[model samples]
Target: MATTVGVVVFPGTNCEMDAVTAVEGLGGSGRLLWHGDDDLSGVDAVVVPGGFAHGDYLRPGAIARFSPMMGAVARFAADGGPVVGICNGFQVLTEAGLLPGALQKNRGLKFLCQPATLRVETTASALTGRASVGDELSVPINHFEGNYTCDDETLARLRDEDRIVLRYVDNPNGSMDDIAAVCNEGRNVVGLMPHPERACDELLGSADGAILMASLLAAA
Candidate 1:
């Protein structure tokens, strides 16, 4: 059966359609699940696409984490469902405690919008299950607060447990340990700074993102 991925749409989400288009292009159907609704409608997987949820008021994803749909996402995650978050959506996952760490302002206090080279650090998470470790992917990242931060203890645990899924090849944002993507302890939820949906097509600069998206669909 073709996989159906739920793309969560928040108040200020602008990349919902991008995610939908990417998933559809990958032979998976994308369903938009509103932030106000708690139902998931039996999606095979979920993607929290990038955007300024709640206008990024009081910090990115701070308010969006309280949305009813996030509660449903959390429940789905707890049941071992695959959940993937990109860019701003990554912040939402952290705020909702679905993933570890937090996204702070980018290094140099600037908004970064460019292609980033990322190395697959592990294949244990839903997002990287189909990618081989050390594989390099060219994916675009667009965000002002994409630097990932966490306490030392948490960082150590992430490293020791091999939960870091992706690492930047060039360390563009000064994220701890050059981290670009991470997965939860259960390995079902993943959060990443790069916009994989934007890189799925060769016309967008690179088609390397298809590998990651394919991984999500296969996991579903």
Candidate 2:
């Protein structure tokens, strides 16, 4: 059966379709699940896409964490379902306690929109299982609060457990340890600041993201 992937959407979410398009392009079915909905029964995988959820009020992903859909997502994740969060969605994952670390303001308080070179750090997560360690990918990033911050103990645990999935090649944002992505202890859930869905096609500047999305489909 074709993998059915659900793309979760919130009021201010702008990249749900981008995520859906990327998923369907990879031979997976795409379904949009509204933030108000709390059902996630049929989907094989879930993607929380980018954009300003609830206007990024009171901190990005803070408000969206309380959305009813997130409760369902939590349950889904607990059952070992694949879940990948991109950009703002990454923030939501952290706020929901699905992933570790928080995305704070970018260095110099500037909004960044450009191509980023990412190095695959591990393949244990749902997003990077198809990629090899040290492989570099070109993915675009669009965000103001993309800098990732975590406490010392969390960083130590991430390193010791091989949970850090990706790292920035040139360090575009001031993310700690040049981290670009991370997965939970179970490795079923993942969050990244770069928009792999936006990089699905070569015409969009890079097709490297296809491997990541394809990995998610295979995992699902």
Candidate 3:
């Protein structure tokens, strides 16, 4: 059976359709889950795509963390279901406590929109399970607050637990440790600044993200 992937849509979300297209292109079914909805509808996997949630008013994901849908997302993740958060969605995951670390403004206080080369640090998580450690991927990123930050103890634990899933080959936002993506200790929930859905097609620049989505589908 094809996996049913739910793409969460918040008020300001603009990439939900793109995520849905990517999932459907990969032979999976994509469903839109509204932020106000409290049910997951038995989706096999959930994806929080890029876009400013709740206007990014207080902060990137500060407000979206309290949405009703996030409660369902939390429960889904707790059951070990696959969950991948991209760009602003990553911020939401962190704010929701599904993932650790906070995304801060870029070092130079600039918005970045470009292709980034990321090295796969681990394949233990659902997002990167189809890739081998150290494999390089070309993905696109679009965000202002994409710099990842965490305390020393959290950083040490992430390193010790192999939770860091991707690292920028050439750091663009001054993220600590050049980290581009990470996953929860369960390895089921993943959050990344890069937009894998935007890079899933070769015609669009790179097809490397297909590998990541394929892994997510398999895990789902």
Q: Evaluated with lDDT, which candidate comes out highest? A: 2
Would you give me the overall lDDT of model 3? 0.94
How does model 2 score by TM-score?
0.99
* Model 3 per-residue lDDT tens digits across residues 1-220: 7899999999999999999999999999999999999899769999998899899989988999899999999999999999999999999999999999999999987899999999999999999989999999999989899999999999999999999999999999999999999999999999999998988899999999999988999999
Model 2, stretches more than 4 Å misplaced? none
RMSD of each: 0.7, 0.6, 0.7
How does each model score on TM-score?
0.99, 0.99, 0.99
CA lDDT of each prediction against the hidden true structure = 0.94, 0.95, 0.94
lDDT of 3 at 197: 94
Residues 104-180 of candidate 1 have per-residue lDDT tens digits of 88887789999999999999999988999999999999988999999999999999999999999998888999999
**lDDT of model 2 at residue 91?**
98
